[model samples]
Target: MARKGGELEAFIAFLGGLLAAGLAALAMAGIGLAVRPTPALKSAALVTLGAIWLTVTTTVYLRIKPRSS
Candidate 1:
């Protein structure tokens, strides 16, 4: 069975992408932190990865489905 469309589906998809990207970014951060164990550098890496992931994922989603309204 598939989920019905409407706002809920879009919202869920958006959240899923964000969560996926966030997790990816966190994993990268963990690797960096493990190697150097630095606060600033780790923060930066996480932020950069998360931003990139979010941007790319959102862009892809938008391309797949434009504005709902």
Candidate 2:
């Protein structure tokens, strides 16, 4: 059954995105700390993580949101 898009759906998507992005960021931080990654590597990682977060969040939000007729 198709569900109507509303505040609840948006909230769920936001929450899911946060969880996914947060975990990934934590993992990257852990690895960076453990290995003492180079500055260049660190910069790259930050950029990558930012991209991942944005992409995941936007994608989730869009996917969860129903299109208007």
Candidate 3:
């Protein structure tokens, strides 16, 4: 039972990280578009920002641990 609860908590944390990463990516993309007027530069900026966001999110998710109860 305790193991199951821990798994559930981890799953929830993972989902939350995913949602946060997605929202952040959208915001970054918008900023990239506004900052870079040229199409190529905008695309590059968006991709770079997206990759960075994903990497950070994944690292954070992996570091999350269930609390003792």
Using TM-score as the measure, the top candidate is 2
lDDT of 3: 0.66
Question: Where does model 2 exceed 4 Å of error?
Answer: 1-11
lDDT of 1 by residue, 13-36 (tens): 577677777787778866766697
TM-score of each: 0.49, 0.67, 0.49
Lowest lDDT sum, 10 consecutive residues, model 1, at 1-10
Candidate 1 residue-wise lDDT at 35: 91
Greater TM-score among 1 and 2 belongs to 2
**Steric collisions counted per model:** 0, 0, 0
Deviating ranges (above 4 Å) for candidate 1: 1-9, 66-69
Could you give me the TM-score of model 3 versus the true structure? 0.49
Off by over 4 Å in 3: 1-5, 37-69
- lDDT tens digits, residues 27-59, model 2? 988887789789899788878877777787788
Which is the leading candidate under lDDT?
Answer: 2
Better of 2 and 3 by TM-score: 2
The full ranking of all candidates by lDDT, starting with the best, is 2, 1, 3
